[model samples]
Target: MGRLLSKEDVLAYAIASTALSTGGGGVGPSLESVAKMYDDAIAKGARPELIELSEVPDDAIVTSVVATGGGVSPEMMMRWGGRGGRLRRDLPFGRFDPEYIRDKILENDATWCPLNSWSKIPGPDFRRKAWERLKELIGGKEIFSRLFFEISPFVTRDLCYMSLEGMKAIDATCAGYRAAPEISQSGLNLADVKCTPAVITTVWGDLLILEEVLCFQRAEEIVEGIATYSGGVAGGPFALTGKEAKKGMIPGCISFTIDIGKAILKARESGDDIAEAIVDASKGRAFKLFEGKIAEYWQEPKYSFIWGMVKIKGTGKYAGHRFKAWYKNEFHISWLDDKPYVTSPDGINVIDPKTGWGLANFWPAEWEPGREVVVIGVKNDERWETPRGLKLFGPQHFFFDIEHVPIDKIYKNFE
Candidate 1:
């Protein structure tokens, strides 16, 4: 049986998903939009629900729904001052009222929810076109649900918006617990699931259906091209059936994110240490890597991805050590005191000790010099340790010469 999600679950999932994003995906400002989405759903009397993968009928049609685009930091828009694009330069991403987000951002008239397309919000038009195209391609089979492509605040927000439209949320994710830079990095791809027969859509109402793709790499390039040209896009390849989803997707990840979120919220209310609470919430899969202050940070938007590095000077017990991490939207590599420490296929979560929110690489200004942060390394799903998984997500894929090491082996409960 499936369970209905309470309004609080949506809010909790937002905070938890951001904290687990490993410093990529959407950032903090987007949470305000999520809050409004749930409120709107309640006003409409829609109940968002989640069901286990086993509960889905074997023949049910599904597709991974995701937004594609380079995210612009809200702080960047304030600097550009409406000169770069159609978005209002006056307010940051979260600064807009719900009406403004609903009227402007959600309507695709302007940009918010991190990209110019506003596909992350899955507004009415984007939703309609995507479903129409997907249903058409699938020969009018009822698309039972929209599968979450990644674990991030944007997807969590979209889940609420989608639930209101009658799509049951599956408590699973194709991209595992943390965000990855490429679609091919997903557990689905590693499990040899096909990504073709895909649908791609732009906010301008344009649609492109890739009847077939030679490989996931080609599919990724094509999607990247569309996003690069249109500033952003939304839509995904048909996931076909529940059997395929169960085989490829990481199950229970949404529930896991919510549990972590609830833990953080509860700890905050009880005045408990947020960092410790997060580790406890992760249930031994996560451990403290470094506690420090941001010393230097540099990031640039390149090829529709946030690319950068951060240097942290340790404090407290970690004093005298230094930490460095590099990212292409998501952190892929890190070094502690000049020695390779943790790498992708493992999660490196940078959290603000003050608020327990994951500090995003794009929002450097918010986590600028002197901000205290707790870096947590989370063990990736055991499935990610397979040879095929490592080939796709390991350090080699990121141009690093080091061998892939599990987070547990590298940190081993560094308290």
Candidate 2:
């Protein structure tokens, strides 16, 4: 028998999924987008069934789905304000309200503003005034056009939706299978599965959707692509046999994230200590590495990943210590007082000290200088520690000229 997925289950799965993405060294998608996907799926009467991998046949086909894309930082968006092209900020009302311009572009009615009217505007100044008028009529608020482009791609969310769509397609076809004389009377168990005829997992912002009946065994390659394309910010492959894949791929990762999210929400509702609750929910998997204000943060888009470093000056118990984290899409390496602290494969997450919310890897705008944060490290799957796994996802693979030291070894002094 399969466990029936409820709304709470879906919520838990979404939250845990995000954590798996971030904790596994990938830049996670927005919590809002992921939650919305699960909510929509549940509303449509889609039931996600969780089954152990051992229950699946060795030949059963499985596919992976993940989100892929880096987000534009606020600074980048602001810099592109005056530039022309898709990100141009000098267009009419472009400076005042980007959303208004977006609505106009999306509008289908020709009578409102003919396409030629845009060309008729005499000059830049005239066009500006025209946009201003339109903004006034639409009650637009002041917002930069570049800011409108800051919405990061939620590939994981799309992957989930795509999986649901694929299932629906399979159901339409499988109805004929049920009528076949040779087919079992028990019918196919589709409702209890997240992915039809297989399993599904994700990394931050990237998903690989494949057909169930298809003998696509390129998951290892897909995982490699995620790491290489992200410049070593994401997690490496959990390449295993079908049974091992079911048992070892971040066991209960979805449920774990959901539990953490739920615990935080419940704590916030009851005016309890959210940070404490998060620590409790993680069951010793998560711990505060440093508490400090961000002193410096520098990031640039390199090879499709947000490559950067963040320096924080410790406050309170960790005062007088300086911490530095180098990241590629996700926070991969960290130093405490010039000694190696947390390294890749082990999850390094930044939590807002005030809100106890974990920050996403791509949203540098959210990690403003002077903002207080608690750097937390969650243990990576033991599979990531093996020789082959380390070679694929360790510090060396990330081009760091250092050995793969465990977080416990580095943080033993602090503990």
Candidate 3:
């Protein structure tokens, strides 16, 4: 049994996806446009089903932003093993490489520089060109999956609804943190899109001529509104603005010392009088004086000159770990008071589970990474009540991953 989709509904989805992707997609905003088309179709009274993956039309188009090592082939494996006359290619009895896995990908491109999506698109029509170029870059499908396996055993495993296809250059840093990870191919599948080995293909398996994931059957409505497209990766004005623009983009800079000094330092410290200090510091910065809600107390958390020199004079026993000494930034500084916890993969995120997205260009993590990411176009971002206590990837919670890159990779800096 399936729920029927209407043209109006599809149009709504398009509104949502495009809104979410306001910045860009590799294929000339095609995905967003497609989403809009679906919405339009729904408006026309046509129905799209939120069906199980098992029910996917065999002939439909299926592609994954996720990719496996391309060099690997059935012939090479047979030559190497010399036995196992018949085997299932889809079911790998061993490890797999996922973009999440870094070490293995290095074998293919010594300089397999990492990359992510920017609010704006960087390369050519990326969505379409992935498999062809990646296959050439590595070797081909089979061997490439093998290369990926060396990097990620995680991807090989059958996770809950979706599977991970490892991507990275040999010894890529996704194991913990890596520089710009390119999107060879990626995307999540409906958990049961196609269980049959013949129907569903893994990155490690051969690239089939045609395929599609099972339908999505989740919430009918998105709580978050469509995010407006800003621009490609670095499309934002002064993204990662060296020492100059860090303050305006993020919150809690050194200015907090005088403005919101107490709240910033009270974290993991003498929790006393810190709140009072925050109030005292706010003299002229804010248009209106706030008691505990002093806006000036917060900085963007990047390493700014004002913040570097700013130090918190300890009161009674709390002396060390002073605000001046905090090396990370204002974002990381938040973990001092509130740490994050990694939730299950089912958690909500900026990228839709069904559509899948990559790192935006110009985003902090794109260049040096280990940069704090702030999701600009979150749906329902300004709600008076946030969904849950899950603050790691929550719209309001912006910062680095536990791996210390950004929120996408980890739940919290403290977690």
* Winning candidate number (TM-score): 1
Off by over 4 Å in 2: 13-20, 23-39, 65-68, 71-244, 412-415
Deviation in Å, model 1, residue 409 alpha carbon: 0.3
Residue by residue across 179-198, what tens digits does model 3's lDDT show?
10112111111111221111
Q: What is the clash count of model 1?
A: 0
Rank by TM-score (best first): 1, 2, 3
**Model 3 bad stretches (over 4 Å):** 2-4, 11-50, 57-62, 67-336, 342-415
Pairs of residues clashing in candidate 1: none
List TM-scores for all candidates, in order.
Answer: 0.85, 0.59, 0.23
* Residue 7 accuracy (lDDT) in model 2: 51
How many steric clashes between backbone atoms does each model show? 0, 15, 94
Model number with the top lDDT: 1
Residue range 214-301, candidate 1, lDDT tens digits: 8776677677766654433334555568888888888888988888888888888899998888889888877889999999888776
Between candidates 2 and 3, the TM-score winner:
2
- Cα error of candidate 2 at position 29, Å: 6.9
